[model samples]
Target chain A: MDKKKNISMAVIKRLPKYQRYLREMLNNDIDRISSKELSEKIGFTASQIRQDLNCFGDFGQQGYGYNVADLYKEICNILGLTKQYKTIIIGAGNIGQAIANYTNFQKMNFDLVGIFDTNPKLCGLKINDIEIRDIDLLGEFLKENNVDIAIICVPSRSAQGICDMVVKGGIKGIWNFAPIDLSIPKEVIVENVHLSESLLTLSCLMNGAI
Target chain B: MDKKKNISMAVIKRLPKYQRYLREMLNNDIDRISSKELSEKIGFTASQIRQDLNCFGDFGQQGYGYNVADLYKEICNILGLTKQYKTIIIGAGNIGQAIANYTNFQKMNFDLVGIFDTNPKLCGLKINDIEIRDIDLLGEFLKENNVDIAIICVPSRSAQGICDMVVKGGIKGIWNFAPIDLSIPKEVIVENVHLSESLLTLSCLMNGAI
Candidate 1:
């Protein structure tokens, strides 16, 4: 396998799709898949899939395609899913609660270590057996725990402050569901999940605007 | 203004980012912004921003910056957010309940008209004054209501079946939160909100793999 160096954002975006389809194929008992067949299934061109996968290494041949199990495992390794990642969610609101209840993460070894909220009423509440702690102790919590990712589910008004706290608290990666755009250092990566964007995309599709 | 024929998916994906940054600029009393300024704020190249925005129309010029409020409203119109869209939520679990409680949608004119669940225990349960309805009656409910978008918050196992029901029930645009990708007709747009993908992206970033 080749080491990935400065991969394009476009290629990075396709990794999860590859992972998802490969897992589906594995579940269906399909052991091998061709670039042509993958293109048909995913609607991407055969060459596009080949180019995206080639960034990691030359695993699949010209005609033989790729072995399902091997490709899935490789993609898992590339995605850092091969190891358990300890995760925490800040702001246990609806979005936070939904994310906290997402068992897929736990199933994939992305453990939910802590859940915190600024709402005083929710400080002592519990979800999925993980008690909601006070946001004030987040820095202390991060100082003590080995949290790999911080999930921000706060509102637009408080998201930036909470994000600053998160960065100051030593979390390097942020999965932000806040409506605002967060500025961070180049070393830290912020993945923004804009719910409105999806809705608007659907709206644009429905209206034949795009 | 261009009619936007065959606008690339790359450009479509950036529309929300443009909309978002413009909204933030408006909030901060920054009324005008050039492509270069937008690029500095969003981390996208100036030419890329110019190209993305030009796909919609000649909003920005060589020397003059675009007006924030006007640009935002124009993008909103382009995104089909100017009109109110009635929406429905299937599978009133944590995800569905959370979406129903998201007032941000209401702020954007995407109104929540119905929330449904297969679980009888949750039928009469209320969130934000809207009671959950029976999933069996979704077809009838859709037939009577003007639901423009159907939000699928079901699990992976039942997501496809609910997707089929939603499509058959008459809603065209679907915002799916299910872990699985649903197969639908070509005309019907199904946007899958894969929370795991985001987490995995962070995982990859955290691992220094991507």
Candidate 2:
């Protein structure tokens, strides 16, 4: 874990995909896999896979390959999946409500402790039995609960304001769904799911690739 | 457009972000901007901005910079936003319904023509005036409608099957929200919005960066 100090973001971004493929293999009773075989399955080249795994620590043997279960656990550890994170969604709009109903996140150790929205009508409504709280109560709720991640499902205009409030209340991670790229302090981690940008990327590629 | 032949996927992905910032400038009544100034706003280095824009065509002048409106229009053209795309949602689940109700995509020229789900009860329900049809009707629907993009919001197990149907129906672009990476033909473009992988990336970074 100490060897992970300065790993490039490109390598880090690929870790989850690696972990995902390993989980599938593990489910299928695969005990071990060579980098070349994993490469074919995961789409990364053999040498690339080896280099990415090496960023964390020495893994695999001369010809024996990586132990599937061991690698899966190791990657999960690196990804902090062993620990539970209390998360709250701000702005219980369509996307926010959808995420709240996405109980898979809860199974993955990201517990949705609260949901907040500015709309008064939505404040008492429940999604997955979790009551949507008023946005005004977000700061107070944050003070009482040890929340780890703030899922910003608000619109672009209100995203930064909610982000500032959450950061001030001691949130460290943000899973932002808003179109706007948030301004945050260095210590805070923000992962954006810019739907429009992603869709545009698809269109751009499809247009040119054709 | 001839210069776009060999542009890297990395540059193509950044085009949306560049367009987004340029649009903000346009809305603010900014007629023009220098590369350096644009870089400061967009978070890309000035040289990087110049190089990315150069992949399409000559953009900013040496001393005069660029016309924001012209750059925005050029990016839109390159991104294929100038053309209208008929899109359909496969799987009327939470994410699917959210996307169907998302009028923003409609405003962007990606019109949602139809939605299909396997659940019998969900069929005939309307979202944004578009009725959800049975999954069995997807192939037929595609044949009748000139759908350019298929948004697959189905589960992992069903995504590939749905993807095969859409591709066979002449869908050139796919906005896949399913966690599993779909196996698609080279002629088709599939952009993924893997939510689980994204959340893991955030948690992984939060762990390491701290």
Candidate 3:
């Protein structure tokens, strides 16, 4: 963990987008790509691409460009996606089921190992071979299964409580889909996916003079 | 439209967070608030808050602080949430359904008017009193109804096609939840919500020294 090498979390968030573009380029047999080319394809500026990639290390030649395969591997290692992560999604509702059924997460090194919900009617139900377990078993199951990440798909009111339980159950990373923000310990990391904010952004763009 | 304002979309995205806090203060009957106090509560610096708000107008006093109600109403107006916007969601899947069922959108002056899905099996389905109609009806629906915002919640493979159709159907604003980024015309506004990017950010926060 090189503190000096700490990239902006904002930049890190776009690694997957870069990865997706690189994958497509690779599939299309594109061996090398310039910052300008990548930027044009990805809707970012050429300088932004260079600045973000330079944070890790020099992966590009002076006049030439970045080797598609090499840059892909470097980004993968930097994003901690070189290996699969054991993940569990809590709340077997619509959003939770979507996570369970999502195929892209499989490509991105997240393995949905289990799902938990307090709804008795939903317990024992299976979505694509993954059974929905009772929330009562979350603590023991997380410990036993050594789950590293837990995605909270519960309602806003239940988010903080579930986050506390997940952290206490030894899961430090959480991807929250709830509208409310959670206050976790310094050791725990919570990322909020506020759908409303995204909608509001679209609304502004619609209403703006642009 | 205040072209001089030129606030970054990122800063605009955080206005809702500030509004949320201001609403809390109003609920608690806190009549006045300084930039420092608001910053401390929201994890932003006082200068950042001042700058973000200053893009709209100066509501702060020299010695005292901002009037809570006045600032709140000003921020709301700046966000264009003073007028209600009719939003229709396409693809009645888990994420779409979740957006329909979400209560905060209505609270934020967005009305979830309609839901569309191409799946014949899901036609005429209802979520939270809103009916899910056939995708073929989107054009007439948009013309008939007052829907100004269209949310694309379909699969990644189908997202681009739906976006094209929606744009042709007279939708100027799109909130795309699919993983892939669509190339929309300059006349149309498209905001993407990538779940994988959010997950990767959480992973980095958990693993990196930051």
Backbone collision tally, model 1: 0
Using lDDT as the yardstick, the better of models 2 and 3 is: 2
* Residue A136 lDDT, candidate 2, scale 0-100: 88
**How far out, in Å, is residue A80 in model 3?**
1.3
Which digits, one per residue and each the tens of the lDDT, describe model 3 over residues B1-210? 465358787787887788778888999999999999988888889998888877777788977988899999887676677778788899888778877887778888888888999999999889889888999988898778766678889988899998887787777788888889998889898888988888877776666634
Could you tell which candidate, 1 or 3, scores higher by DockQ? 1
Best by lDDT: 2
What tens digits encode model 1's per-residue C-alpha lDDT throughout A147-185? 878899988888899888878878878999988788787
- Is candidate 1 or 2 superior in TM-score? 2
Worst 10 residues of 2 chain B by lDDT: B1-10
Q: Which digits, one per residue and each the tens of the lDDT, describe model 2 over residues B71-133? A: 899899989999999999998888998898789999999988989999999998899999999
For model 2, residues A1-210, the per-residue Cα lDDT tens digits are 456687888988898999999999999999999999999999999999999998877778878999999999999998999989999999888899889999899999999999999899998999999999999899899999999999999999999999999999999999999999899999999999999999999998888742
Q: Candidate 2: lDDT of B99?
A: 91
Steric clash pairs (candidate 1):
none
**Cα RMSDs, all models:** 1.9, 1.2, 2.4
lDDT for each residue of candidate 1 in B121-153, tens digit (9 for 90 to 100): 999888788889888888899888877888999
Clashing pairs in 2: none
DockQ of candidate 2 is 0.70
